[model samples]
Target chain A: MIGDSVPQGDNEAAAREVASGPVIHIRNLRKEYTSVAGVIPVLHGLNIEVMPSEFVAIMGASGSGKSTLMNILGCLDIATSGSYLLNGHDVAVLDRDTLAHLRNDLIGFVFQGFNLLPRASLLDNVALPLVYSKVSREEREARANEMLGKVGLAKYRDSQPNQISGGQQQRVAIARALVNRPQLLLADEPTGNLDSHTGNEIMNLFKELNERDGITIVLITHEVEVAAYAHRLVRLADGHIVYDGSSHEGAMSKNPTEYSAAVHSTS
Target chain B: MIGAMLNEAWVSMWANRLRTILTMLGMVIGVSAVIIMQAVGQGAQQEVQESIESMGSNLLMVLPGSSTSGGGVRMGAGALSTLTTNDAEAIEELPTVAGAAPSVSDVAQVIYGARNWSTQITGTTPSYFSVRNWDFAAGAPFTDTDLRSVTRVAILGKTVVDNLFGDENPVGKIIRIKNSPYVVLGVLSAKGQSLMGRDQDDAILIPITTVQRKLASNQVAGSVRFIMVQVKSAEAMPKAEQDIVDLLRQRHRIREGAENDFTVRNLTAMANTAAETTAVMSLMLGIIASISLLVGGIGIMNIMLVSVTERTREIGIRMAIGARSRDILLQFLLEAIIISIFGCLIGVILGIGGALAASGMTGIRVVITISSILLAFTVAAAVGVFFGWYPARQAARLRPIDALRFQ
Candidate 1:
């Protein structure tokens, strides 16, 4: 049921050989939106493979299709013409309910808005996933508390999202994401609403979680400094990858003016 | 899972306290109206039944009904009296008959001291009091000797004495009835108002022989107005009524297929008719009150829709955290149910209070039944579930992408 079941280019073998196997596999992914005007192609023939326990960042300017790619990766949307296998399950073949289960059990998402229920306590927000998983209330609370402690917000477990700072709320979101112990964590601009220092702190927490707990993370951001925290960087230009390499080399190649020109020429 | 949903529902409801309370007010008023209206209808029914019962149980009346025509001038019932004192005696001798009294009545001006009031003057034997379950409030009732002697003694009803005497004792005082002087023998107790809204105590009673001989002697001689018969028991009313009809027909020599001159009326049948009318009235009132509950349910639906729209982002966040559509539906539905349950509780208390307050103000006995409370509570809960379904479904059907992006 993995995307590898479909014949892909030679890059599949190279990606599989990097580790035991890749946690996220997408080949020739395409997405098109239809409105009253006509069909607008957003993502076109893009390929991305993420290995287990790796911290990867996707960087692109506006209209470069990075958000669309992140939505597909998070199982919130489906590819129009492509194969996406999330932890060995083919995304396109799953129904809506099964896709929800896949997202719940295998993937956790963090948003730039830090999408936590405004009236819920930090503990309740973190324990929500386990409630859907049918976990006992005591165990759910225990695990939620443990995750909060990991993020150093255990004392603020009873605090509501509005009562906390944006950085603290983002941290609570991180705790909630990790509470289920999902294999893949998807964050779309996790630090977009934070100051530079708080953004650095959030990135460092991600780095620590990746190194200490071996949790795979895929983050999407347009800021180079934010992307710098990732071990690997994948840059998108007009719905196609322009560079996929080490963060330092990718940063060196990411010239804003040149990238915008290249993006315009492609569209 | 349900417990968790309920917790979430309660939390969400508490988040907007004013809106929840305002929404619940409709249900509260609706439930209370239902109970108060039902009580009023039931109380009216009871009042009618009691008034009929006070007239006396197992009682029957024989009336002269056959009209007479001479030269195309038809005389109505009692224009020519077909009922006589002998018919009353014959009815009393029947096996099921308890007692009978021959009665005649006329509207006359009564005079005592400087006061004069126009009231009904009923002339009957002493047995009329027992037959109608009436008792003397002061002095004593006139006996058979008074009837045989054609004594000018009268029994005054409470209202008649109050109007003519103004709280003064009337027993043994001389009064004028239709210009004929008579002594008040005793005062009858108050019987309140009849079901027809007429005053029952605005009358006086004297011997039938006196009325026939002195007052209405020119109209019909030795004839009576009607016969009041009391049966031994409630079970004997029908048999006694039939016996009276048969004996009267035979005595009048009413041949086969010939119309009888007398009519028999059973108090028991009249009582049943009154009871049936009351039952139907209460049922109708209950149905009308329930419509207000339906309107209250619609109010719930309206507020729930607004809540679902306001909490779109919250729903998306929960869905992102792995909450299914059913989970979202259940949460909102539970919130509605909690509101309705609390509303119903407060409504029940207020309804009973309102009923008692009405009873106090109107001097009517309002009955609050357990079945009504249960039915009202159950309907309230059902309304919550029914109205909550559509809005909850709308919330559940929201796409996570759209809801999360909602402003």
Candidate 2:
């Protein structure tokens, strides 16, 4: 029933219609988990579209299935029902290995915990994703070094993750995510584990990467400050998008139901 | 991709050096036990084989009436002597018979100047040397004329020479046997031991005529205790044994309806039985050692399972980045194989060292064969693949989302 709603107004759709194609397009996506209690549904026919080079932030409370959507967008998990098209290819039909290839070739992931291998050197950690891509050693090192420099951590490449500060470790994870030069970057609570200062610094870096590299980014965060960095904001409430509009407008609106003004294009 | 997996596995294992070594201990002990047992078993078999070969080929022992023939030639004491040299001479003329020598043995004191030694004195014709594959160290053996004329000539074995002459050449030297002076004909070469662990070079050889007439005079009218027969080939052994039995029976004037007065025993069959026994022993040791290897493999499997559980986050991160199930499987399997290969190398060294130590400390012969080492390595590889597979599969089967969510 909720799939019929287009939360954004006609003007926003008219603006996005000029882009050649959508990088991510999902229709009636539903996911379920079986437990001893019964089948617990996580997503209820959620639908969304993200265009190329678009920076979209997803906001929700803990159980609103924002993380589940991020997983599906990154190709890490499949929807139990619905169609997800990544790079114009249906992800539901792709096998596990092929999905892995799709993720490797097109998507990058950043997590709240940094997710860097603690024992590996910063350089090695950054080069890890390229290893799965079967990149040559010399090429992997060259590309990893370039990404580290881009993240402003070039001098500490040899240092281990545990030896670095939390902010620096997250930057290293960003470098790793970008090392594959993936077309889409997916970040889940990228600044959730940091202080306000370090978190702002990271958000600025993401903004710079999105603008300068023209890389499409889908970020999931509940904080208003973190979501404000993205141009477009998508708010999920009970497994459906309650607000889809400008990030500034979404952050200023205190209550989700108030997004009706943006949805209906009314005062 | 596989190379990267191998590098990842090496790095992971090296990150936990102490744990890796501890987990490898079981494999080390198991492989070492297998190697040591195989070495000792093969060593024993080789020693037995050498002794069996040294005892000559296609041999048969002919015993007199009312005597039982065991694996070796048993000299009956106080039994009536029924066979003579004439019977041996007649048997040698048969088509399958190569040569035959009638022999008599007695333990007597031998004196060379002031040095005196009590040793076994075997009396037989010169044909005994060929039939028993005996060789001389110094001079020639006594000829046929010496046996017919009852000449006092003797051939001393290595042990007798060492005891009576102290490294001197005993040939042409006069030695007294039971107070009768006899000229030493030659010194026999060293023959290590028999299948029954008897020293083959500890006695003396003298003419049968001389021993029967003067030194041991226990026999009645030129009769001897036993005859040694050598067949032309291994295939002729059974027929030659039968021929010798019939010839001896006819020579002793036994009727067709009556039981034979002498028994012919095939020495080759006895040696074969000894060989088979040692082979069986070697196989048994190998089997027992493999059980310990199995235990070691189980230890590897257990430790790998724990490692997979502990490294769930690492697996998730790799999978999120883009590692396939096959890549994860290769990574864990490579880790297991590396541990076991290193364990096997250390085990081989320890096993060889143990075999050498056992040989040095004790008098038992130990042989370390290359085939045994190869067999151990093959088994170790098999164990690695066998035990490492299950844990690797588990690691590969983990869902990326669940693993990433895991604490």
Model 1 chain A lowest lDDT segment of ten: A3-12
Residue B367, candidate 1: alpha-carbon lDDT: 84
Q: What does TM-score give for chain A of every model?
A: 0.89, 0.89
Q: List per-candidate RMSD values in Å.
A: 6.7, 5.9
For residues B1-407, what per-residue lDDT tens digits would candidate 1 score against the true structure?
A: 77778888888888888988988988998898888878888788878877786687788888897665676765666565888988888888899988899999889998987899999988898889998888789999999999999999999999999899987888889999888899999998888777677888998999998988887745477678888899999887777878888899899898999777878888667777877888898888889889988888899999999999999988887777777788888888888899888888888889899999989998877888888889889999999999999999999898877777788
What is candidate 1's CAPRI-style docking category based on DockQ? acceptable
Clashing pairs in 2: none
Q: Residue B31 CA error for candidate 1 (Å)?
A: 0.2
Candidate 2 regions exceeding 4 Å error are: A1-20, A258-267, B67-78
lDDT, candidates in the order shown: 0.85, 0.85
Q: Looking at model 2 chain B, which ten-residue stretch has the lowest summed lDDT?
A: B71-80
